[model samples]
Structure formats: structure tokens, C-alpha cells
Target: MVKCCSAIGCASRCLPNSKLKGLTFHVFPTDENIKKKWVLAMKRLDVNAAGIWEPKKGDVLCSRHFKKTDFDRSTPNIKLKPGVIPSIFESPYQFQEHSYSVMDSPKKLKHKLDHVISELEDTKESLQNVLDREKHFQKSLRKTIRELKEECLISEDTARRLDVFCWECCQESTE
Candidate 1:
């Protein structure tokens, strides 16, 4: 006869004695010397989560748990609240995308604002340089014109020449 797993939500049945059912059993306390070790081991096999164990008659204990008995010993004492599943597993891709979206979503707006501020600063700086150069050029041209007039080097007929010279000098100053 086979026994069904007493574990909640588990439908696994006990290994059958028939070859088809494929159940294997080992002699309990395989060695007299190991018996003491196993007895000590079983004391530690505590499954905290399941709170119980359903073992079949003559079932060989797994070697992995040979040293420890209470299978649920390390599991947390966490109980699911009413109407809620105990496990919460999210897809890896969804978690990756969600993390990216959370971290990157705000950066988009911040980057745009930073660009705008930089453009404004550049514009302000360029305008100030232009204004400063213009003022210097105006002052230099006025002084040059006043000197030429006082020295009688500038005549009404040479007005165009003076204008050309002043324009070239102003351009050179800017460069």
C-alpha cells in the first residue's frame, strides 16, 4: 500500500512495493555505530514551514539530511495572512524593466531641464560679450573721429574712407 503525502497542497504518494510503483527502502539504523549519529541527527530535523513530516515505513533518509532531522528547522515561522498566497515571485524581465523605468523615468525630465538651463546660460554669455565689444568699438571710433577732425586729416569728401576704416578696425577688435 502507498501513502499520500500529508503535506498541504502536496499530492505526492508514497513509493509502492511493486516494481512499477518504484519505491525503494533501506534498512533503518543501517549500522550500529551510525545509529547514535542518526538519533542525534533526527533531533535536529525540524521543518519550521511545514510543521510536520509524513514518512513512509522503512524509507531511507536522504544522506543530505542525514546529519539533520527536522527538515523545516531553518524555515521562517511566516504564516500567510488570510486570502493571500505565501510566495511572491515576479518575472525577471518585469523586474528589470520596472527597475529601469523607475530609475530612468525622472532622468528624462531632469535632462531636458538641464539642457534648457545650459542654453539659456550660453545665450546670456554670448549676448554680454557682444554688448561689451560693441561698447568698446563705439568708444574707439568716437575717439578716432575726434582726433582726425582736430588734426584736419578728415575732410567731408573722405567721410566714406573714415567710415570704412572705422568699420574694419571694429571688426578686427571683435576678432
Candidate 2:
């Protein structure tokens, strides 16, 4: 019997490929066109669920196959696809779990929106207060202008000073 390593193209049989005795395995392509050639080359190996033989080297197989050498028999555990089970919302247990996650989401969003609205309301109130103060200041300014004009009528120098002050006030207001 020609001895071969489990890996691709070393030709040196440095170690035993199979962990157990008498059972040999190899991986081969499952495609129908290539299956016959693979089966013919690796004679004693059977295809597993994945169509892989235990000791596959690249795409080809060595003549010697991996065989069961130990008394302990181990089989691969198969897993089902996630989609095979119903959607999370379908089962009551799943629905509750999903609902809990969704429930947590909107609460934070609602809180943030509420906080933003409160901030906006506070800003609006502050702006209105500022506008009210400005209106009162303007009314007091008009009264000061009437008093200045009355003082200007009493003296020409006072009239010149009042004219200068009025022009400065008008320029500042435009700015």
C-alpha cells in the first residue's frame, strides 16, 4: 500500500492521516461530472453530508483513504437553517422578546423628542422676554427725546447738542 499524507502534495507519509483504525475518509467534489473520476481515484472512501472526505488535499485525493481506527464512533451534529423556524413575532415567547426590544427603542426616542420640545419652548419664552424688554426700552427712549426737545427750545446750544444726540441715536438704531 502506498502511504500518503492528508495534506496536498508532500509525498512524505510523516504521520498517520486517520485518528482511528480501519475507517478511511476523503473529500471529493459532489458535481456529477467529476464525481466518477474522484470516486475511481480514491477507492475506499464514502462521501459525508458535505461531500467532503476526511483527508482532502486541494481538489484531488490520495489513493489511501482515512479509516476509523478507534472504537469510539463520532458523528457530525447537523444544524437546521434559521429560516426553517417561524418568525420571532409568530411564537408568544419570541413575540415578547421582540416586543421588549422594540419597547425599549421608542421610549428613548420619545424622551429625546420631549426634551427637544421643552428646550424649544424655553428658547421661545426667553426670546419673547427679550423682545418685551426692548419694547419698554424704546418707549423710555421716546420720552427722553421729548424732554430733550423741550430743553433744546430753552437754549440754542442745548438744541445743537440734542440734534447731535438724535442723529447718533438714529444711526445706532439703523445699525
Candidate 3:
């Protein structure tokens, strides 16, 4: 049986007589939670709300809505990791035009700010770890240099005493 994309405004359809090759429809995940998340994401994109938003067993979301990073494309067959939500959408104008208006909502602004703050904290922690490692390496290098210098001084003192003793013995033998 032929299948078609169920995403809103998508006109893709699969037919037996079609000349196009390698076009495959991906069914929504069977897991109820995952399916619900996909439905929520779709609802966000559907400005018109033309039809029932719920997805059923046969409903498919085409590859166009997803980014390359969303799928594991290394193998022959494309696969999505479990719990991965499709966030990328085709409407750039809607986001660009209404971004400020959307951000004006207090709850959304707070949520976005919280996300940014969390990311900044993670970066700060990582940078601190790197600095701590560098400090440890510097301390070890200084200790090694000090030990080597002490060894060199001791060797020099021993060689000097040996040279004096040999000179005295030579003078006594000559006499």
C-alpha cells in the first residue's frame, strides 16, 4: 500500500508509479510518550489548526522536518535515537517575524533565560576543571626542577673534593 506524509502543509505522497527513488516514509514512534511529544511539537507548528492534531498508527512525519543531526545516518538505514524530539521546522519567517513577540511572554522569557543560565554554568565548570589541571601540572614541573638542581649541586661538590685529594697524592709521590 502507498503511504504519504502526514505533517501539516506537506504535500509529499508515495505512489506505485512514481519515478522518484529512495524516498521512504517514517512512522511515528509507537511509544505513547514519544508519540505525545511529537504531537505537541506538531501542534506548535500548526498555525492553521486545520485538522485533528493527534497522530495514529499509520501517521508519518517526513524527513524534511528533521535536521541531519537528528538521525544516525552512518549506517545504511537511518535511525533516530530514543526520546529524540523533532524540533527543527520549515517556517523561518514565522519564527523571525514573531520572535520578539514570543519572547515578550514572561513565562517563555523566563524559560529561555533559565536555559541560557544553565548552559553558562556548565561552561564555567568545564573551564574551572581545565584551569585546575593546568595549575597541578605547573606545580609538579616546579618540584621536579628543584629536585634536579639539588642533585646537580651535590655531584659538583663531590667532584671538587675528589680533584683536591688526587692533586695532594700526586705531589706526595713526586717528592
TM-score for all models, in order of appearance: 0.30, 0.31, 0.42
- CA-only RMSD, every prediction: 22.9, 22.2, 18.5
Candidate 1: list runs displaced more than 4 Å.
Answer: 1-104, 156-175
> Any idea how many clashes model 1 has?
9
C-alpha lDDT of all candidate models, in order: 0.49, 0.47, 0.67
Q: Model 1, range 7-71, lDDT digits (tens) per residue?
A: 23334454544225532222335444554444343432235544333233453432222222222
- Per-residue error at 166 for model 1, in Å? 7.8
Roughly what TM-score does model 3 have, to 2 decimal places?
Answer: 0.42
Q: In candidate 3, what are the lDDT values of residues 90-175, reduced to their tens digit?
A: 55455555665344678878998999999999999998887677556556654555565577844655555554555565456445
Q: Which candidate do you rate higher for TM-score, 2 or 3?
A: 3
lDDT tens digits, residue span 1-175, model 2: 5444443322434236443433233335455555554444333233355454443444433323322231134455222222121111112234345533346667777987899999999999998887677667666765676677776644656656765676676557546
